[model samples]
Target chain A: MNKHKQVVLDRNKVLSQIQRLAEVAKTDNWQYEYDAQLDELVYGKDFMPRDSFLFNVNGEINLFISPDSSVSGIHIEYFQANYLAHNQELQPALRAITKKTIKNQRDNEAATALEIELSADAFKSLFSKDQLITVL
Target chain B: MPEQEHILKCRDCEGKLVIFHRHNYDIHKKKHPELEDTAFFPDRVRNALKYPTFTIPGNGNSVTCYYVEEFSINGIIKYTKVVLMNKPYIMANEKIHHIMTAHKVGHVQEEKYPGLKKQMYHNGNKI
Candidate 1:
């Protein structure tokens, strides 16, 4: 068929694989939530084959899956990079600092928690790439 | 047949090395399942962030599973002479390929969803 059609089929195949992988991961508690097509929303119009679906994992991290690997390819960006890079400088949660490091501060603690969980590469990939390809 | 003719002439080209095949893996399955076997992409992207060039299997002869079709486009500029294949590739059957095409289009659907595209591009700081 056409390239677009082929992309759609490929996405489904990837999803099926994800489903299998998720099951294999066997997380004690995991839920899958369907999201509106994000690709069309980005491309401005929808055509044959449809677009990638969205997912909110555990109320955090909106995981996107689609054939437009260009933009969709997860490359983290923004504070995520700084976070991953700077996370090492912070004193361990169980360690002692100047009676007051940013981690000890309530506001900074919350921000640090989120930052700690991400990697430099993944964080950049998430936002830097351009979203390419759109389906019906 | 369609590719054989193309291969014959390229075989005699005196310029750069003429590569006629490729190999890769199944990102989803890990199995390097044999490809259709045929000629594939002309260049390779060695970056981890990049997706990769496809590998369409060869023909009845020494064809490799290296996909050799697919172009790039960005409005005013359209590069059709190039093949959008992948490296360290994976086996994408017709069925799997179809699913992929549809899923990508789904992303296109998102572009039309209200101000979604605007929001995503501007880092959601705008919309």
Candidate 2:
């Protein structure tokens, strides 16, 4: 196959993985919506642009799966307040991390939510770094 | 139709790095007729070599970087090259290597070429 075809196939494989995660979300009652045209699966409705497709794995952790297959990757974003309150010393270091960016902020509180894009393999392993779970 | 080879060299090692390879001139000419006009072609080629753009992942677009090199075969320019530089030590820059690595991973925008982001955005979910 051509290189471009290979890329499309690889993206489809990653999309299948995300589709499995979406199935798990449905069973867990995580509150999700899927737009077939957009290929976007949003998890929470109240958040709209912010909360659209976030899967609240627990009360603390939220997962946002990007709709576009071309950029097929999972974004694991932490609720800013909850993350900082528990881990204070790590905040400065985390803030220093260049790739980590703040997203989905609201007017009510400070923009505490920070997200890091993870590769398909990393997402499959639930963002495990050095055999340690980086995000819960 | 004879095939011509083009090589893009790595500045650090000065090794012949082949980044782009094309064997058909007629198809290339059909794709880029602007390159056929010899009168103003050199200037246009110079401008293209001066401003090479690389696609940024997830941004669905490419941004021009200020580094490039042009290669010619038999007085006919074949391809342009970008030199990867080190911020500190001359050793292989990990950042550039990482970007290249990330690019290998399946995360690029769907658009085939550059400057198509506006049209893709307007299409919206259709793509």
Clash totals for all candidate models: 93, 4
Candidate with the greatest DockQ versus the true structure: 1
DockQ list for all candidates: 0.04, 0.01
Per-residue lDDT of B61 in model 2: 21
- Which stretch of 10 consecutive residues in model 1 chain A shows the poorest summed lDDT? A38-47
Judged by whole-model lDDT over C-alpha atoms, candidate 2 comes out at 0.27
- lDDT assessment of candidate 1: 0.23
TM-scores for all candidates: the values are: 0.21, 0.20
Model 2 Cα lDDT, one tens digit per residue, A35-113: 2222222233222231112222223343443233222113222212333446564344243332234343331112122
TM-score of 1: 0.21
What share of the reference contacts is kept in model 2? 0.00
lDDT of each: 0.23, 0.27
Q: Taking the tens digit of each residue's C-alpha lDDT, what string does model 1 give over B1-127?
A: 0121111111111121222222111121111011111211122211100221222221111221211122433321111111111221223321101011101111121222242212111211211
Off by over 4 Å in 1: A1-116, A119-136, B1-127
- Give TM-score values for chain A, per-prediction: 0.20, 0.26
Tens-digit per-residue lDDT, B38-93, candidate 2: 63243433332334333112221222211222332233222222212222222243
lDDT of 1 by residue, A1-136 (tens): 4342223224333333333432322332221111111111111011111233332122123234444431121111112222223556432322321123343465356433332342232334333434323232
RMSD of each: 17.9, 19.8
